[model samples]
Target chain A: MVKGKTLTYGVLLGSICLIGAGIYRNEVNIVLKKAVNLCLECIGIG
Target chain B: MDKRILTQIIATIAMNGNIKGFFEGSIFKGNSKKLCVPGLNCYSCPGALGSCPIGSLQAVIGSIKYNFSFYIIGFMSLMGILFGRLICGWICPFGFIQDLLYKIPLPKIKVNKKANNYLKYLKYVILLVFVILLPMFLVNDVGMSDPYFCKYICPAGTLEGGIPLVLMNESLRDTIGFLFAWKITLLIITIIFSILIYRPFCRYICPLGAFYSLFNPISFYQFKVDKNQCTMCNSCSKKCKMNIEVYKNPNSMECIRCGDCAQICPTKAITKNFSTKNL
Candidate 1:
């Protein structure tokens, strides 16, 4: 269906744009900041 | 025994390839942690090489400075559109564990269809409430919130990250408290249920699975049942671990695209197509 194709391509394009925006905003560092440390909460220590 | 299981093993090893961390009792803190793996891997796992999207999303949303994460959302969306729950079927370490557990000689319990239809919605509710709302809305005096799902619900985090870390670190054992006990209980229940059921968590608990299921109908990679070759044998439906009626709806939200249906189809009526032509 054309609708499915449109939605799929639309989402793909939107994802690329969002990724670009995230990089520009230095959001990767946010993930890094959290992941690099031992998350006691994630381990259910808290 | 199959390519899918082999792929699962390779992916599990690939994502948690920091084998040294398992021995050291410390999680990997390398630059690779910036990337998010496509499955429900815990970032806190001792050998994990990448971040978990759900946890990262919660962190960003729960932070005072931000209520959204463009990178994680984008990454998850891309994966969802491309492969949907194929990630659940093939690559997820937890999923692989469940598959292996289900292979045990224990009798499987097939949930009632009516109950299953309703229970499947619980994952969506969990995604909205625990993964999104609680983290975004409930904050401490410092304007920060907990990763609610990871703290309270995720057996993957407890099993992959918690138990190993505790077993390795004697100091951490002293900090074990009610939450840890609760998580351990949950993990035990999940393990037991996994033996009696095919992917009980994936069917009724995993928010990540719920997220990916939404894209099944429209994902670039999809299933198509050929009308010409179809015999309506219904064997595919009977064999589906997710309990999907493949011939009736090849692109059901419940289908993980494990290719079991395609493999079982006597006439090879089912095909995994790369085209996004029909929704």
Candidate 2:
């Protein structure tokens, strides 16, 4: 039980740190740039 | 209405409800696409309202930066730890489509248990090779790589986005090549196998499912079996589409947490629980 809790907390903390860094690095725009465009290559239309 | 039916409707709609994209021949260019839905819905799908986490991860990593895949990893981590493959059960567009196809009542195919169990590990191999390693190392001179899984493998993107867009736009037909043909063949095979076996892709080939399965052992929400109530009649096992022996290990990686076991347990031996206690 304690182990599961610890693992879960560890994952949560790690996620927070990553998300914080993503924001700091302006990664949301990177994701948005990809997402907003129709990925022609992905759909085999390229 | 069944919980599965209700959630399937909602998830399908949420994933592909961008009405304007259909007439405009454009994918939704919205802020929502910045957010990854916990399913395999293609961001390139004309009607898709959000990004796919796996695709996003591959794209970001392939851009040749060793920077952290923070946004997608965080989102996927939270989802994995919270409900595990419940996302596969209730939210995946392709999984829902497979369920609908399986309802067509074809003579089902069941592989022998030993082989079936061994085959489930193939998805992990796919996750490592296609989604992670290839994109990580197989770069060209420009220090960029392709999303090998998306470009070469993912039938969902081909079916959901490629076919639709090509059908809608005649110009896309000129671009058809060996890659497109291969993806089409894969989609057709997946569609056929989905009818023969329940979630064959999820069971043996889905990289996303592979990632989510990592959390099944320790996820916060899980299916619990009440050993005292179990008569070992095996009704739960029989009803399982994923072929899980639910009464034995309710939290097995093979289980999709679809509640079929709990729904079928004659003595109410299984229940969904949110507690941290071990089963």
Candidate 3:
């Protein structure tokens, strides 16, 4: 049971690390670029 | 009237607070658009303040420059790990819409248990295929790919973003074609199904729900069933819209953590968040 909890927290920490790496890589900029523009496809107008 | 309903309402309003955008037929261009919302709210919804994680993930994955999105995946994983499908129960605008649809004074159709078990796996397939595989592998001439799930399947996008945007903009209305018609058809089908079945989309269609379900057993927020207090009366199971035997599996993947089971447990056997119960 302790092992399972450890694994869960391990994954959580790993996810946070990934988020940090993504931010460093300017991936959030990609999201902002796509989001700021009107996505015609998303609205089914394309 | 319940806390859950209040939370859902507040989440919807807080996430889509740009009311002027709706009136002006424009999308919000705020800094918050860079952040992904935990639940499936369409970013193109005129009033949306944050990006939909699934949509943002697809946007990043489908882009020619980026094959994957560590940020979106990490954000979604963090949300899943912390709350599981409590986001679905208490925050998702689309889920709230389905819940409202199901409340209409119409006869409900309970799916057969044998078929339901198999049907629940479909969303996982959608997450893998439409959201992940197709976008990553199937590219246009320029090596960019479409957000296939958002473009083709997501009824939430159509209902919340597509219809409203098109209605508000004459230029957009002129651009509508078979794809728009098809999306509207899907939206209609989803609405009808929501009335007949409790959260058919969340149960069998939402990729976000499928992704969150993966962490339900291990999430920080969890349900605890006290074996000592339980009466085996199955009141929790009876109250569960997800058809989970709460006493047997308090942390089932299908559980949205709606707290109905905790509320209905006659012996007060069920508890949420932190508990000393073994399972």
Q: Which of the two candidates, 1 or 3, achieves a greater lDDT against the reference?
A: 1
Give candidate 3 misplaced runs (Cα > 4 Å). B274-279
- What interface RMSD does every candidate have? 0.9, 1.6, 1.5
Best by lDDT: 1
Could you give candidate 2's per-residue lDDT for residues A8-27 as a string of tens digits?
76876776777777767677
Model 2, span B205-278: residue lDDT tens: 99998888898878888888888999999999899988888988888897878898898788998989876776
All candidates: TM-score: 0.98, 0.96, 0.98
lDDT of all predictions, in order shown? 0.91, 0.85, 0.90
Error of 1 at B228 (Å): 1.9
Candidates ranked, most accurate by TM-score first? 1, 3, 2
DockQ values, each candidate: 0.84, 0.67, 0.74
Off by over 4 Å in 1: none
Q: Across residues B58-85, which tens digit of lDDT does each residue of candidate 3 receive?
A: 9989988888889988999999888888
Docking class of 1: high
